[model samples]
Target chain A: MADPIDFWFDFSSPYGYMMAERIDTLAAKHGREVKWRPFLLGAVFKHTGGQPLPSQPMKGPYSKHDLARSARFLGLPFTMPEAFPVSTHQACRVFYWLESRNPRLAHEFAIGVFHAYFVDGRDISQMDVLEGVAGKLDIAPEAVAGATADDAVKAHLREVCEVAIASGVFGSPFVVIDGEPFWGVDRLPQIERWLEQGGF
Target chain B: MADPIDFWFDFSSPYGYMMAERIDTLAAKHGREVKWRPFLLGAVFKHTGGQPLPSQPMKGPYSKHDLARSARFLGLPFTMPEAFPVSTHQACRVFYWLESRNPRLAHEFAIGVFHAYFVDGRDISQMDVLEGVAGKLDIAPEAVAGATADDAVKAHLREVCEVAIASGVFGSPFVVIDGEPFWGVDRLPQIERWLEQGGF
Candidate 1:
């Protein structure tokens, strides 16, 4: 089997959520597995000097419209959360915590967090919301709380983000396959082609 | 026939060049025409506070790689010009000047300019290079020179750019189908689907 594809995304990113829903199945088709790495886009933006998509001028409204249209195109249900572009530190920490224990459970937890925020319109930034999401997956509330406040988990996420920057990850839904970096959910097709062709 | 699709792009954009090559054929497949609008992205960036892709930090290097990869994906030849993101004022003026006389000829000239800059690696910003491209199409060199110098033609180009901004065009290779804006060469699949399904 080939090495797992690194899927980097911020929990608050709509495109990231969309990619998360599809990447596993897409990779499975080509005999590949995806390693989901949740990182803070805000931290990455600090280095790139990029703002959230919804905060720009004319592009802001267009991005909102595009997100809804893209959702319909992908046949995925999406409701724009009233409070968008929220912090994902808690969610990332919990994900990294679960990842250390069981990678599969961590992947499922990540998906649940994405669904909570993107579909249910729940704020995963809050501990209660993340606890609710983790509870659904048989994870204890105390464990979720401990992960969020754990200094080690926080440091682990920070290291992941710094490594992401070093590897040239500037956007959410970034995929790196064999050192070839593909950014954005839009690059899904290219990633699929790359997997099928083994580097095109 | 439905209204023609509005294809907006900058002469210096790599994605725009790729879209220019494919949009016509894709639109024509759906029995639609495209209005190729060449406007200055630099002007739009001033309003949106966006910078050229190659000028940013990590994204700068990634964009160059993506351009080459995208070119291969699309089966098109691309050569990064030594002088990139050049001024297209002269090219735009000449385009509008010819457009007033002949839209078809102007479309051909637009293709010529894109080919000169992206494929041939010629500095289309230079008058001599523009003349060389124009000469091949049997367009008069003197006419090209006159259009470049004409104040009215320059003003027309400016008006075109202003209108592009008013239409919420903030990026190169932006397409609008019945007020549905799709940005980037990555949106080509969505554009094709929109044309096929008549607004999906």
Candidate 2:
């Protein structure tokens, strides 16, 4: 079997959430699996001098409209959270902690967190919210709580961000198939073609 | 006939060049026409605090790669010009000057300018290059030279930039279909859908 696609994203990115909703199915169509790597986009932004889309002047407003339009286009439900672009370290920590144990469960938990934040308007930045998401997946709440504060887990997340930056991942919804990097959910069609044509 | 799709772009933008190559064909498929509006992205960046893609840190390098990949994907010939993101006022002015008298010829001139700058790596900011491109289209070289320095044409380009900013045109390759704004060359698929469905 070919290597799994590296799907890098931030829990706070709406585009990431949108990609998360469909990446697996898209990958599966090509007999490929996806490695969901939830990293802190803020850390990557530090290296790139990039700001969140909703905060940039003209881009900010356009992004909001685009996000909604894109969601509708994709037939996904999305509501911009009031507490948007919140610190995603907490959610990232829980994701890594779960991923270390059960990769599948971790993917499910990531989806839950994205749905909570984007569709349900629930802030996934809070520990209780993350623990609630974990609880739904039958993950122990105490373990999730412990993982959120674990130094090793925090370091691991940081290391992931560093690796992403080193790999030239400056934005969320970044995908690395084999060695080729594709950024943005908008590149999905291109990604599909790349997978089918094997690097066209 | 339906209203023309307002296609706004910068002469220096690679993505804009890519979009310019296909937008007419795509719009014509839906029995629509495209209004080629060449404006100064630099002026919009002033209000948007945006920088050129190749100037940003990580995004810069990634943009270079993505541009090449996207060009190849679209089956279009593209070479990164040595003098990229150059002052586009001369090209814009000449375009508008020609557009004022003849829009079809102006569009043909715009494509020639894009081909010269992007494919041939010519520095289009120079007056000689503009005249050369105009000369090919059977346009009088002296008239092209006169348009390059025309005060009214300069004011017209400035007004175009102002109008672009006021319409929330923060980036090049932005399209407006019946008041719906779509940004990026990546948005072409979505634009196609909107044109087909008349807004989804």
lDDT of 2 by residue, A165-198 (tens): 9999999999999999899999998899999999
Clashing pairs in 2: none
lDDT (Cα, tens digit) per residue for candidate 2, span B1-200? 88999999999999999999999999999999999999999999888788998889888888888999999988999999999889999899999999999999999999999999999999999888988999999999889888888999998999999999999999989999999999999998899899899999
- TM-score, structure 2 vs. true: 0.98
Candidate 2 reference-contact recovery: 0.82
The runs of at least 3 residues in candidate 2 whose Cα sits more than 4 Å from the true structure, single-residue gaps closed, are: none
> Model 1: clashing residue pairs?
none
Off by over 4 Å in 1: none
Q: Give the Cα lDDT of each candidate.
A: 0.93, 0.92
The C-alpha interface RMSD of every prediction is 0.8, 0.8
> lDDT by residue for model 1 over A114-178, one digit each (tens)?
99999999987889999999999999999998998899999999999999899899999899999
Model 2, residue B175: C-alpha shift (Å): 0.5
Residue-level lDDT of model 1, residues B1-200, one tens digit each, is 78999999999999999999999999999999999999999999988889998899999999999999999999999999999889998999989999999999999999999999999999999999998888988998999999999999988888999999999999989999998999999999999899999988
